[model samples]
Target: MPPTDGPYDGPPAGDRVLALDLGTSSARALVLSADDASPVPGALARHKIAPTYGTGGSATIDLHAYVEGLLGCLDELQHNGHLDGITAIVLSSQWHSIVALDNDGGALTPLITWADTRSVEPRLDPAFDEHAFHARTGAWLHRLYWPRRIPWLLSEVSAVSFAGLPDLVIERLTGDRVTSVSIASGTGSLDLATGEYDAEALAIAGVKPDRLPAIVPSGWTGVLAASYARRWPGLVGVPVHPPTGDGAASNVGSGGYDESTAAVTVGTSAAVRVVHPIDQAPELPWELWRYRVDDQRAVTGMAFSAAGNLHAWLTNVLQLDEAHQEPTDVEIGSSRVIAIPFQAGTRPPETVPGGSGVYFGLSFDDDAADLLAASLQGASLEIDRGLRMLDTLFGRELEVVLGGGGIDASAWWRRCLTATFARPTDVCAEAEVGARGAAAVALGLAPVPGGEHLKPAAPEVERIELLRPRYTILRDLAVQAAQELTRYTSG
Candidate 1:
């Protein structure tokens, strides 16, 4: 796609920005006031998307179906007159999903998401140094990134080009195949020092530079293609900004724009991130990743593969009712059972190959509520480990701001997290943080106001302090067992 003539002038008063958030399970669109970056009342549309799962660790979504769902959202917004006076369009999409494209820009394979584990044990060249690669790309040689996924997919199918889901969406709208640094940084290919794809990493993935989308800066803007202009007449000349990673957008929206404040988001999965200037970021840690928010800012953090998904699985398997799922009276660290919550495997620093969830110390007296409480506690402990690492990285305690659908729905889980972290945490009140953040990025605005301050109770904190050592012991044992099991099975 060709670039717009010049930088977009600030929107006039009363104009709005149409923000789209493409997540793992849904496509959402909302209108925000340009003046304050607040969502316009009743100017929102959403469409649910279901990904296909397979027994071979495959997780994918039909590319055309996903795009059509987003367009359908626009159709609804347009019908409701929400497109009037729209000055620009911005988007936030989940990172690390890739789809292969044919020469005509058509998808040759379904979009593979971060949850897919088909490449978990990827074969790499003997000369590849994992630490050196991580230093250069700000990503690990893990299945969630392109380096592993690329070779695995190529062996199974043939394709000419590869792009993330958002890249394809941008191409469909603007007739351009371009991606932002923020998105590229998550692919395990971008070089932090150069702000471009690393040639060595690309060679490992067996991809040429020409096969990938052009790398664009964060604030880059393009106009809708002529075909799309006719489809949505009101947006004929509106400037559309490149897609920002959903994690970075969440940080901005939740008021965690600098090193002083850390954002913790728990949806299908969970992550903790802090934004800092790209040049000023601390040395990369093996336990965490550093992804770009744009050309100037980088987000450093760790992600957990299990969060809400673990909660859902446990609740279903235990046959818990609504009342049991959110038991208010359950005391922190009170349950006799201990759990290693790796229902979807592990990530960074604490990785366990093919590891699954383990419930230890279960007795005949234990009920579903006891198991559920223990499971949540296990997940909280995992997050707490990552937070402590962040504290050490900065050499000081940072303020924590929490958001995401999981936290909003469960007061019990919030209590567990607070007790585990033993710090004051603030919960964001905005329901559409990703969309609001995307608009803020496009408009050059500050974070909006936050909501609900939570301070850890002294007694609960004391209880967690005692329980943490036991949890640590169990975690170590679990990891050892998993490693031995992998070796035994392979041999």
Candidate 2:
């Protein structure tokens, strides 16, 4: 079928592409000019959506509602006639989400997100070789992945099929039963050395090959479904690339497509990642998850399950307002209220939840501002720990390319990161880097010129001097806290 040229008066088409980035709490669409890596004026749409929070760390979203939100974004782009002259419609979506489907492709279960922790209750069998499992699948036996979640899911439903959210979304858009290697790599099921599902993982999940989609390379593409094409004439025959996990896309979008630059993002959670060829996969750390960016390249990183969400939660609890929220040097330094910011959870090097948030040195003199400063400092310290591990794992001193909404909004946090890590850092240029990355993958690498470098702010001499000693104290205390939590939980 020929591509449709609609009669609507649209912006002049010139090397434009439609890019969609589906995040945890929002869906965003951008009409980007691939020629210069810039979004076309007035062709952007964003909508806020969130998962339904349940007890016992259950984070879920309605599959139908998610699809409708995505479609709504696309419809807004269509209404603006921004789909004109698009090269391809590409996607980047949140990782580690599982959905169960019935025979007619209807959802039988809510999309269980990475944050869902019900699977943590299942104890991995002692006979199970966790190291071998991690080596084969490039994932841990955590509740975030399919290993535990799949078995736990089976106990609740009798769905005929199961796949990640990306797989289902791609199937809906293109009528193809396919998933990207990037997406599969995050599932705790795909063999890292081979771009296929691991037999052992499938056996553990009690799933068969029929329940999963065929894995494709990150840049693989298929034609849009004819049924959907008839509804949006402009997208009728445009190539729709397979969806990629947002982590890899974020790396590409932030210009961390190679080993020289490490990417750090802080949204609801935080992560530290570097995309390199599979040859660079480190001497197997049981904690660091290595997932494929494509057939040839892989992303090695640690995901901290707690980050900006903690910041938001504290702000609300303290009733903090803009008036008292000034992030001055004094506020940054004078706050001796040290906090261990793992209220959500912790990943890798530990692979267990940090159990709780702890505050030290909180005295009667401390106020909300001091509490806020200490919390930010706690987050910076966690990122520092992850960065140090990544450096050791990769055997390179990677420059930091920081992204995500929470970190971008706070100069104080960036400065704190600089002092805490004692490394070069830069805030990423494109705020919506995940979408920019999918666009780059589909159209080709059109880098946002000058986007990768935000010069690290000068560190305060006294603050650095103070933190140098306190960091050791804080690190030791955090390690002790985690050890205690581990011992108590096991007992």
Candidate 3:
């Protein structure tokens, strides 16, 4: 048994459930107390997501390292006595990942994470229409999706099949080779309307349907594998729910079950998503993506390649102590600079190569603090554009429920969002929305659990109003930069 917090008497152990969140750079496990609907104190454990980076934007995770990170969390849970009381284990993992598996289910290659860009030049079939492809799969034609990577992998590696990270982890845990519908939806191979492998997509990618795992509902539950059972006796027969995409879990975890509220997530990347029941597929803009959370609800959103990654870069350039911390009381829109915030290139609207960052209106008088504020403001402006576009699609302006590693920690980040959109913003208390959402799905919570909501401050309103003209200028500059980059890449 693990050490206790103290001489504490709370609800019995049976009311808790274990939630595991596998992300891009780390994995976290926590025991959620069903009695109070909160994570048990001192039960949260995290391990770094150390991926091996190579040249040409190649980042891969060794299968051993990935499994060890998970095992490390389980060890901490066992040490802290979190497993004994847990009734079930639920999982949420990063989307858009593919792992090649051999004939015997052994990993043939390091997991080709979502960040890898080596498949940019795949041999695409001329019969395949990219727009129609996007319409059917609800994912754009990009290197991140399977359409580009699968064909490239077939040419380079001798692999029999592939699976996403969530399904791979589930196989390791439960000896099952199945994927949740939510996870499959992000693979760029599943047809959104049919919820099955798309024949045309498979034809284009030169992949067979059998190469993918069986698809099941996100709430499907199974038992732990015998191997893991022997290793961890406490979890021998604990029910394990099928794993879903972390983004879908975050929507549920942040209380975005209906159309009235949207989920705003800003971690390494940023996105603005809204969840609604499937009602004949709303006419979405060309840039937006449509993914199913389960069988009934569809999550439509726009994603950005830049967010906290941009913040990290600016911090290193500015030499700040904290990457996300706001500098001392600077007025918004007061700086004479505007940053493009596309140091990593634009993800939505289109993927542009060589789209370098642009700092417009920079003057000699401006210091690092002013530049940093301007960059943050530029990102917020892009977010504002997405929000407005989503509103047009939904035919109504929706309130936002903000949650993610980035927004959960920084008040300044939250303030920027609230002021930019001129709407009420609430900070979701659950920093690990993905994990909390997994637990909620296992426990059958209708709305999941959302954290605190922080309202906009009065002082930021004036500053936000002053940014309207600057926002127009920023948008124009971004368009021009993207256009120039497109021409250069084409040339």
* Colliding pairs, model 2: none
Q: Which stretches of candidate 1 lie over 4 Å from their true place?
A: 120-127, 353-355
- Model number with the top TM-score: 1
Worst 10 residues of 1 by lDDT: 1-10
Tens digits of per-residue lDDT for model 3, 1-491? 22122322323544887888888878888888755346788888898887777887777988778888888899888887778866778888899898878899888888888778778465667676878888888887678888778877877788899888888888878777888778888888889888888888787677888989998765467778777765677887777777767888888787776787778888887888888876676876688888877767778888787788788777887778864357456676566677777777777446554346778887888888888788788888877778888888888889888888878766777777888888887667777778776665556565543556666666676777677677787767777768876778669
> What are the clash counts of all predictions, listed in order?
1, 0, 4
CA RMSD (A), model 1:
2.1
Candidate 1, residues 1-491, lDDT tens digits: the string is 46764556667877899998989989898898887677899999999988898987788998888999999999999989889899989999999999987778778889999878777356667988989888788898878888888888788778788999889889888888899888898898899877899988898788988888899876579889888766688998888998989989888887788898888888888888888888967988888898988878889898888888888887888788887786566788788889988777787555575447788999999888888888889988988888888888988898898888788888888888888889999987876778877777767777743678889988889988888899999988988888778788769
Count clashing pairs, candidate 2. 0
What are the clashing pairs of model 3? 25-49, 426-453, 426-454, 429-451
Model 3 bad stretches (over 4 Å): 1-14, 35-37, 120-127, 322-324, 447-459, 482-490
